[model samples]
Target chain A: MWQKLYTWLDERLGLGDMYANLLDRPEPKGNWWNTLGSASLFLFILQGATGIFLTVYYTPSPDHAYDSITYIMNDVAFGWLIRGIHHWGASLMVLVVFIHMVRVFVTASYKYPRELTWLIGVGLLLLTLGMGFTGYLLPWHQMAYWATTVGTQIAGSVPFLGEFILKALRGGPDLSALTLQRFFSAHIWMLPALLAGLIGVHLYLIIRHGESHFPDEED
Target chain B: MSGSHLSRRDFMKAATGAVGGVITAALGIPVIGFLIAPALREDKAGAPIAVGKLEDIPVGKFHPFSFTITKVNGWERTASNYGGFILRNSEAPDDILILSSRCTHLSCTVNWNESANAFLCPCHDAKFGPEGQVLDGPPPEPLGHFEYSVDDQGVLTIVPVELKSEA
Candidate 1:
C-alpha cells in the first residue's frame, strides 16, 4: 500500500531531480557586486516573513493602530523580536540594494548590454525606498506621521501633476484614515508585488546578458 | 616593479583585497544592522526617553535631548514631543517637572511663556502656571506631568506622559 502511494505521489508531484535541476546553486560565483544581490534577497525574505507576522496583529485604523503596536510590543509573544527583525530587515534591504547599485555604477556595469537591467535595477531601488518610506508611516506615531506628511507634501510639490500625485497617494485632499489604508495596501501588496515582478524581470535580463565585467577583467 | 614580473605574493595580495572588498561590502551591512538596529528603531507605542540636567536647566529655560524610539505612535504617525522643567520650589527643593506639550483645551502644545512665567496654550487661551496649575481660560486642568528623576549625574530624566484629560 505504501509503495503504491509513493509511486502515485511521485507520478503526480514529480519530485525526482526537481531541486537538483531548478536550484543547481550556480558555481556560487559572480563579480564582486554579486554577493550583495544575494544579501538583498536574504533581507527581502526576512522582511516578508516578519511583516507577515506583524500584519496578523497590526490594525490599520487610526483608532487602534497605536494600541495594536503597543500590544504587539508589550503583550504578543516575541513581539519585540519580530518587530525588530521587520524594522532592521527593511532598512538592511534598502541598504544592500543601494550598495548593489553603487557597485554596479562604480564598476561601470551599467554600460552597453546591461543598461536595461541597470535601469530596472535603479527603478527597483527607488521602489524599495518608496516602500520603506510608506511603511515607515503606517505605525501612525508622531515622527512617522509628521515625516510622511513632509514627504507627501514634497510629492505634492511636483509641477502640474502634484495634486494628482497627492490625491493618488492619500486618496483624497488630506492624510486621513484612507491614507493609512492606501499606504498599507501599497506597502504590503501593491509595491511588494510590483517589486517582485520587476526583480524577476531584472534577474531574467541579468541571466540573459550575463554578469557584468569586474573592475579588472578579461573582456 | 618590472612590467613582466607579477610575483605570486603580489597576485595573491591583490586577489585577496579584491575578494575582501566584495565580501566586506556584502557582510558589512548586516553586521552594522545587527549592532545598530536597536537605536534606529523606535518603540512606536512610546519608548522611555531621558532628558537632561535638572540643575543645569536654569529656571524658565527648556532644553532639548533626543533618543531613538518608534515614531509610529498612532495609526497616523504623530510626532512625539517631550518637555521638561527645572524649577526651584521651597517646598520641593529643586524638583523636576516634565510635561507633555499638549494643550488642555484641545491638545495643541502650550508654549513656555518665560516672560509671563507660564505655559501658554493658544488653542483656547489656556494658561498653566509654573507649577502646571490651571491659570486661566477654557482648559479644565494642568498640562500632563511625566514620571521623572535626577540620575546619579544630577541629569533630569522623564517618562513620556500623554497630555490632555483622560476623558
Candidate 2:
C-alpha cells in the first residue's frame, strides 16, 4: 500500500529524485568539524520553534511582561525546560555560528569561488546578533530594562545619525511600551525573515559550490 | 512490488520512520501540553492591599504609599511592589482619593513635586495635579485612580486596577 502511494507521488512530484539529490551529494573527506554548519542550522530551527511557543503566553506590556515570564517558568507544564532550551539555545547558536565562521576562515574556504557563501554567512551572523539584542528586552525585568538603556545609549552615541537611530530604535527618548512592541516585532518577524532568506541563499551556494574540500596534507 | 520481497533499504527506511515517529510523539506531547497549559489555567484575581493609616497622609497634600501584592500566574506566585498616592482633599474633606503613581503617557512612576505642586514623570516631563488630573506636558490623560476603602480604624486599603490605555 505504501509502495503504491510512493510510486504515485513520485510519478507526479519527482520526490524520489529530489530526495536522492539532497542526500546523495558528494562531500570532502573531513573530521567532526564538518558537522558544525548542520548543528548551527538545527539550533536556528529549534530557536524559531521555541520562540513561537513563548509568544503564546508572553504579554509584551511592562506591567504584565515579567509576570508572564514568571508564570511560564512556574505555572506551565515543562515551561522551564522549554524556556531553558530557548535561552541557552540562543547563546549556543551564537557560539556555534562563530566557531563555524572561524573554521571556515582557518581553512581558507572563504577564498575564490566560495566568497559569496562567506558573505552570506556574515549576513547570518549579524542577523543572529540582532535577534539576541531584540529578544533580551521582552521579559521587561530590571536587568532587561537597564541593559536596554545602556544598549540604546550606545546606539545614541553614533556620529551623524546617532540621535535619529536611537529614537527610531526605541520609538522615543525613553524605553516604553513602544520600545517593547518594536523590539518584539523585530525579534520575531523582521530578523527571522531576514535570517531565513539569507539561509536559503547560503544553502543554495553551499550546494552549488559543494562543501569546500578539506585542506590537502601536502598544502 | 511483490509482498513477499522486501529490500534491505526499504526495510531500514520503514524501521527508521517508525522509530522516529515514536520518539517524536514521546517528546512532542509534553511540549505541546506545556505550550497550551498557560492558556487553559484560570485567571487569578487581584485582592485589595492595605497601604497604611489614612492619617499618615496629611490634609491638602499628596503622599506616596507602596505595598507588595502577591500575584499568582499559573502555578507561580510573585510579590510585586505597587505604588499609589493618597490625597486628603481640603476642599472636600469627605472625598479621599487614591491615585496610581504610574503616568498615563508611558507608565513611568510619577513623583510628587512639592516645589512645583504637581506630580512629575522623569521619563518625558509629564505633569499631573494633586488630584491626579493631567496638568501639562505629554500625558494623554489623567493619572489612574485605584479603588480604595478605609476601615473603622482609618486603615486605607487600595486595589490595584489595570489601567486602560487611551492610545
Candidate 3:
C-alpha cells in the first residue's frame, strides 16, 4: 500500500528523477574536510530556526528590548538552550564557512567552471557577517550599542562618501531608535533574503560542476 | 537465518529514518515550547512612578523630569530611562498635565527648548508645543501623556505607560 502511494505521488512529482539528480549523483571521493559545506548548511538552518523562535519574544525598541531578551533567557522554557545553540551556531558557521573556502582554495576548486560558485560563496560569507553585525544590536545592551557606534563610525570615515554612508547606515547623525529598527529589519529580512537567494545559486553551481576532485600533481 | 532476512539496504533505510526522526524531535519539541512560552505568560504592568513634588514645578510652564523603571527578568536587571515635561496648570493639585518627551516618530528623547517654547527632538528635529501637540517635523502625532495622581503632600506620581493624546 505504501509502495503504491509513493509510486502514485512520484509519478506526479517527478520524485524519482529529483532523487537521482539531487541526491544519487556521482562525486569524487571526499574526505572529512568535504563535510564542512553541509555542516555550514546545517548550522545555517539551525540558526534560522532558533532566530525565528527568538523573535517571538524579542522587541526592537530600546525601552523593552533588553528586558525582553532577559525574559527570553530566564523565563521562556528552553529559551536559553535555543539561544545558546544559535549564538554558538553563528560562530561555528563562520568558522566552518571560512574553512570550507580554504579547502576549496587549497584544492584549486575555484578554477574555471567553479569560479562563480566561489564568488557566491564569498557573498554568502559576507552576508553571514552582516547577519552577525545587525543581530548584535537587537538586545539594545550597552555593549551592542557602543560596538555598533564604533562600527558605523568607521564606515563614515570613508573618503568622499563616508558621511553619506554613515548617515545611510545609521539613518541619522548617530545610532538611535531608527538604527536599532533598521538593523532589526536588515538582520531578519534583507540580509537573509539575499543570503538565501545566493545560497540557491551556489548550490546549483556546485551541482552543475560536481565537487571538484582534489588536485594532485596534474596540470 | 531470521536475521539474514533483514537486508543491509533495508536496515540502513530503517536506521536513517529513525535517526532523522530522533533529530527532528530533539530540536522541534523544545523549540515549540520556546516560541509559545511568552504567549502563555501573563503581561506585567509597570508600577506607579513618582516623578517629583508638584509644588516645585512652576505654573503654565513645562518642566523637564525623568524617571527610571528597573525591570528584573530572569537573571538580569535593566534600568530604562524615561522622561517627560510637567506643566502645573495652577495651584490646584489635580490641575496638571504630564507629557512624555519621547518623540512619536522614533522614540528619541525630546528636549525642552526654553527659547523656542517647544520640545525639540535632536534625532529628527521634531518640535512639540507646551501642550504636547506636534508643531513640526516627522513626528506622526503629539507627544504622549501619562496617567498621574498628586497626593496631599503634593508628590506627583504617574503611571509609566505612555497614553496617546488627541491633538
TM-score on alpha carbons, each prediction: 0.52, 0.64, 0.66
Q: How do the residues A2-112 of candidate 1 rate in per-residue lDDT, one tens digit apiece?
A: 989978987888755553444332443455566797678767766776787688779988988888888778755566777887888888888899998888888788999
- How many residue pairs clash in each candidate at the backbone level? 16, 1, 0
Model 2 / residue A200 / CA error / Å: 0.7
Better of 1 and 2 by TM-score: 2
Using TM-score as the measure, the top candidate is 3
lDDT of each: 0.72, 0.84, 0.86
Better of 1 and 2 by DockQ: 2
Best by DockQ: 2
Candidate 3 per-residue C-alpha lDDT over A1-219 given as tens digits, one digit per residue, 9 for 90 to 100:
999999999999999999889876798998989889988887888888888888877889888889888887888999888888888888888899999989989888899998899999999999999998898888889899999999999999999999999999999998999999999999999998898899889989888888888887875
User: What's the distance in Å from true for residue B86, model 2?
Assistant: 39
Q: What is each model's TM-score for chain A?
A: 0.85, 0.97, 0.97
Best by lDDT: 3
Give the runs in model 2 whose Cα sits over 4 Å from its true position.
A217-219, B1-27, B38-167
Which residue pairs in candidate 3 collide?
A: none
Ranking by DockQ: 2, 3, 1
Error of 2 at A70 (Å): 0.8
lDDT of 2 by residue, A1-219 (tens): 999999999999999888777655788888777889988998899899888888777888887889888888977888887789889999999999999999999998998799999999999999999999999999899889999999999999999999999999999999999999999999999999999999999988888888988678875
